[model samples]
Target chain A: MNYKASQMSQSKKPDADASRSKKIRQKRIGDQLRRLYDDVTNEPVPDEFLSLLEQADKSSKQK
Target chain B: MDDQAFKTELAELIPHLRAFARSLCGNATAADDLAQEAMLKAWKARASYQAGTNLKAWTFTILRNLFYSEKRRSWRRQQLDPEVAEATLVSNDNPSSAIELLSLRNALDELPEDQREALILVGAGGLSYEETAEICGCAIGTIKSRVSRARKAITEILESKMSGLTGNDSLSAADAFEDIMRQADELSRDLPADA
Candidate 1:
């Protein structure tokens, strides 16, 4: 990590400000990723998924 | 494991399987189809699975293998365009969160398949590096570097887009970062498993 977004800009912000802003940005991205994942995980496991499992179970026993 | 025990475990892991599939393909319908196929495959291969191992990791490996093989077979990079994918995956109820997720999803698309999968597995799928490396069929250090580079790349992409940085500076900066990544990759290839 270069730890400096300020390098790309002409603004003369201090290094500490640049570092803290980078950290905040990273934290936001991490949280956003976890939320994206959990949104799908939190969805109602479609009925087809449940029935498919049961169907497999029953057929295996019958065989 | 007994058939009953296997069924119990498989049922419990359904949501996770679906999530991993969705993240890989970015489509709800296709993801379910993939997840369902993996479940059946796992059931058929139940006898081969060692009992008391990491069942989630095993199933994840199965799902990921199915995803890639199917992808290779079809030769389709994307099942849905970005706009359609974003509209389908995110609800419009919360504008801010939707924007946040939509942008990341687009940024994630820019990464190579290896790095994208590596980042998803470690960063969001709640898997450890060893498990991720196993699932990805790569070195542990390779997974680390992919993830590290992915985070940096996404941050750079997102930040540049947000800050309205001058195109010339950002382009040059990106070129420099690419050079650094190539060097880092060469060095990481020989990194010890635990290093």
Candidate 2:
């Protein structure tokens, strides 16, 4: 699909102001997504998943 | 690979697996269910797992597949539930940061599944473009485009919501716009003059 070609063309066409705004927005979004990622990753693993893994290990040992 | 080593790797990957699952589903309960199911599936197929390959990618592939399959089933169930349909229109009344995060999550949930997956895999999961492409079964360019589009969509949605909130409330839209413009100005100033 020549995705890179199209993307490059789009970037080259945008003027400095437009491109600057786009970059700013992209950076802001990246920061927000990083925060969201941190929030999710820092959460403790639920006990059910730990119990489930133990069960799986025991059952696999029986096989 | 020894079973003990493999088990340790899997255990260490559980948090990331859950993070990916949560990013995919946006519901803690459903994410845990998906993660647990994927872990069980990975354990069952551990014999087929190659020694040196990326286990995280392999397990993520399994979880993504399971999520899609379950989504297909739940799509039908949601169609039959009036409450599920109604929930789409309900908005968070509180405009606190917590509510803003909820709105951000909702915006993410609204993105096309492929774009959301690409964005999360790269932005959150710390996977390389090549790794994400391998997991998604697409070219690296496609993954890049997906992530770019996802970022744009999320930013636009959040900006519109922010402007909307500022327009009617204590905060002024002009101030919000000025803040964004100031940020953009700083970014532009940091750029090289010629290019």
Interface DockQ per candidate: 0.37, 0.36
Candidate 2 docks at the CAPRI level of: acceptable
Q: Which candidate leads the pack in TM-score?
A: 1
Model 1 misplaced stretches (Cα beyond 4 Å): A1-13, B72-93, B165-195
Q: What TM-score does chain A reach in every model?
A: 0.78, 0.58
Q: In model 1 chain B, which range of ten residues has the least summed lDDT?
A: B186-195
Model 1 residue pairs with clashes: none
Give the alpha carbon lDDT tens digit for every residue of B1-195 in model 1.
Answer: 999999999988999998898888776777788899999899889999999999999999999888878755332346446665457446657554565576788789888889988999899989999999999998999999999999999998876665553445545554445334433544454433532
Question: What TM-score would you give candidate 2 relative to the actual structure?
Answer: 0.71
In model 2, pairs of residues that clash are none
Please, what are the lDDT tens digits per residue for candidate 2 over residues B49-162? 999999999999888878777755332111112332233225323223333345566678778889988998998788999989988989999999999999888888877765
CAPRI band of model 1? acceptable
TM-score of each: 0.79, 0.71
Which runs of model 2 end up more than 4 angstroms from their true locations? A1-25, B72-97, B165-195
